[model samples]
Target: MQQTTVAKTVTYTGIGLHSGKSVTITLHPAPINSGIIFARTDLPGIPQVAAVAGNVTNAMRATTLESGVAKVFTVEHLLAAFYAMGIDNCLIEINSVEPPVADGSSLPFVRLLEEAGSVEQEALRNIIDVKEAQTIRVNDSFITIVPYDGFRITFTSINPHPMLGVQFGDYEINTETFVKEIASARTIGFMHEVKLLQDQGLALGGSLENVVVYDDETVLTPLRFSDELVRHKILDVVGDLALVGRIKGHVIAVKSSHAINTALAKKIIESCSK
Candidate 1:
């Protein structure tokens, strides 16, 4: 398959999830083999950071890419859109440390890319084909990838909340399925954890409009899917794995977080390099 890039420039403005600052990001088409590059327009010299596993310095509640003093946070949602849309190259220009948390899902980014359209380049895609199974485990949480003809993910999310006990999802990732199923699934937080998260300097911009907040008994916000939490987990997996190039494999994740997800990406990078 040939590589692809956005056909035109498109921009979006919203509030950052953690920083609580208004930011704007513009997406521009890039040449073949460029992958995804983020330019920090607010910094001197407008330093650029490549979206790669090796550049990931933090993956606490969100994925952060850093090079020197330049840093971009909460990038998983936007990257998930690009990966699912089959966009091979893009230049993201932003004026702040974090991208907007539009609806706390990939849908808004998907809409932006849809508006920009896509152009296929002459170069073939740089696909990382998983020839064998690889697994990374952190306690009870784990992510495993095995050889597959196409990109697929089967995810399981386990939560102690009564309203969100255990959810499972399996999807063959493509533009159609992604837009219909995964893109609208918003990130979630629990009512009990709100103050703690805020005290720790996280989820500062989260609201009912952007996140699905759950109380002890039920979800405070309406859900796009009955299994939205697990779907969002799959969305995050796609985004974190985007650090690697296009992948043809079956990813199986259970109770995995950004750290585990990116660890799997780094493992794949190492395996591919050998």
Candidate 2:
């Protein structure tokens, strides 16, 4: 398959998940082989940051990428949307350090991409076709990928909360399946963590509207799917995997988190390069 970029420009504005500051981002078409790059529009002279695994500095609750003095936070959802839409090259201009946390899922970003449109490029895609298995783990959580003809993912989340429990989802990822099945799964959190996060100066934009919170007693919002927690794990894996640009393999993850996800991404990049 050939590479692709946007057919037209699109803009999105909303509050950041962490900074809670209003920021606007514009997606612009990039040349073939340019890859996905983030530009800080608020800073003068247009400093750019490449959205690749090597630049990832933090993945606490969300993925953050930094290069020199420029950084972009909470990028997983937006990257997942790009991966779902088959967008290979683009310049995302953000007015601040974070992308908007619209509805806490990839849906809004998917909508942003739909509004912009996509066009094929004249070059072949730069992708990794796993020839051997690669794995990484953080305590009980682990994720691995092995050789496969096409891209597929199987994810399991082992949260013990009654609302979450043990849940799993498997999908042969493609443009249609990602949007229809995984794009709308909101970010899940425990109500107990809200106060802690705020005290730590994080998740300032998170709320009942944007995040699905579960107290020990019950789930705060009606779920989009009974297995949405696992589906969102699938969403995150897709975003983390997108750091490899293109992938052709099968991945199995259990109790995945951003740190482990980004670690697996680094392994994929290292393996593919050699």
- TM-score for every candidate vs. truth? 0.98, 0.98
Q: Over the stretch 245-264, how does candidate 1's per-residue lDDT look in tens digits? A: 88999999999999999999
> Where is the poorest 10-residue window by lDDT in model 2?
156-165
What are the per-residue Cα lDDT tens digits for candidate 2 across 72-172? 98899999999999999999999999999999899999998999999999999977889999999888989999999999999888887867789979999
TM-score for predicted model 1 compared with the true structure: 0.98
The CA lDDT of each predicted structure is 0.95, 0.91
lDDT of 1: 0.95
- The clash number for model 1 is 0
